[model samples]
Target: MGIFKRVKHMATADTNHFLDKMENPVSMVKQYIRDLEEQMGQAQQALAQQYWNERRYEAQIEETTALIMKRSRQAELAVDRQEDAIAELAIEEKLRNQEKLALYKTQHEATKNQTAALLEQMKRMNEKYNELVLQKQNLLSRIRAAQAIQASTAALQPYDMDRVHHGLARIEEKVWQVEAQAYAGIKAGEVLNAAPSYVEQEKRDEIQKELAALKEKRGTV
Candidate 1:
């Protein structure tokens, strides 16, 4: 009972101190599994020893019983005082071994039961650990998706919008330049646009000389 009491105290730890050494959920779960395996192994070993002790106690009891029976037969043949004492001591030893054998059998069962319960606890803890692992993976996946979407949106946000505005402004300036060139040509004067050749100048001078003779004849007649 004393040994089991100490072990019980170690196994029953639940809060703060038990979790203080754990760094993360995965490491915590692994450590918990390891500790559970160690405890189960120890309990099983104790159970095995208890069974061996029971068997040895039984064998000793049988040997002592045989000794007691042989001495009884000898005492019946010769009623010696020392022989009677020997027979009585043999009976007491047999009773002691019997008691020990029963106690060991009980201890073996208790150890086996403790091991089984710990195994069940380990099973439940494993299920919980797996669930938490899945949750962490899902959260990571969602976070990645969210980051990608944010990056895409930022690329499309048009942060440097002045570039497009400047392009349109340059196009308008080119149109005004073309319009100004057309107006400038119109203002340069029509004479510069259509100058007569030397042959057209001679024809104009001959027509002016004929008009001067007609005017002289009309005045003398």
Candidate 2:
């Protein structure tokens, strides 16, 4: 009866609602599983006891049937010997044995039925406990998945577009400064290469003088 009461609790419990309300659903579910196992153990013990009782009743019935047979034989022997009083007493004992046999048979049948019912109940409870175990595994998987999603979301929450854009802007500024320095160095090299040396200036002056002299000689001729 107590096991049935606990099984009723298991059957009526709302796992989803219960987990939703609990701060630690996993631990609570573990405890619930333990309770169910304990109740199942008790039920197994009770069923075993019922089976023992059924066997006892069967033995009693067998013993009573043997007694009935023995008394019948005694009555027949007494009648054959012409012992009228012994025959009557034997008949009476046989009738009492018959009554006892009937009672024992009835008890045995009743006990057998009781044992069967208990076995059915235990089978049902085992199925329910297995169902709960599967449900617990599913709930745990879902809980772990949810926790993983939450962790990923929390880890990414701090990186807003503004911060990302600011970092990119800094990198771009550095690149622009490098480009400007390179361009300044190239321009300085161009200026230094375009300037003429003193020897080249002197060579230019001598060429101009020779051209002027040639022009004057041609005009005189």
Q: Which model scores highest in TM-score?
A: 2
Question: What's the C-alpha lDDT at position 6 in model 1?
Answer: 35
What TM-score does each of the candidates earn? 0.45, 0.68
Best by lDDT: 2
Off by over 4 Å in 1: 1-83, 156-163, 174-221
Residue-level lDDT tens digits of model 1 in 86-196: 656655665665566566566656655665655555454445445545655664577689899999998888666698789889999999999999888787655565556
Candidate 2, backbone clash total: 0
State the displacement of the C-alpha of residue 42, model 1, in Å, after optimal TM-score superposition: 12
Candidate 2 structure quality by residue, lDDT tens digits, 1-221: 56666666676777778878888877887887888788888878888888888888888888888888887888899999998899899889889888888888888888788777667777767777787788789888998999999999998876588988999999999999999999999999887876666567888899988888998989952
Each candidate: RMSD = 8.8, 5.8
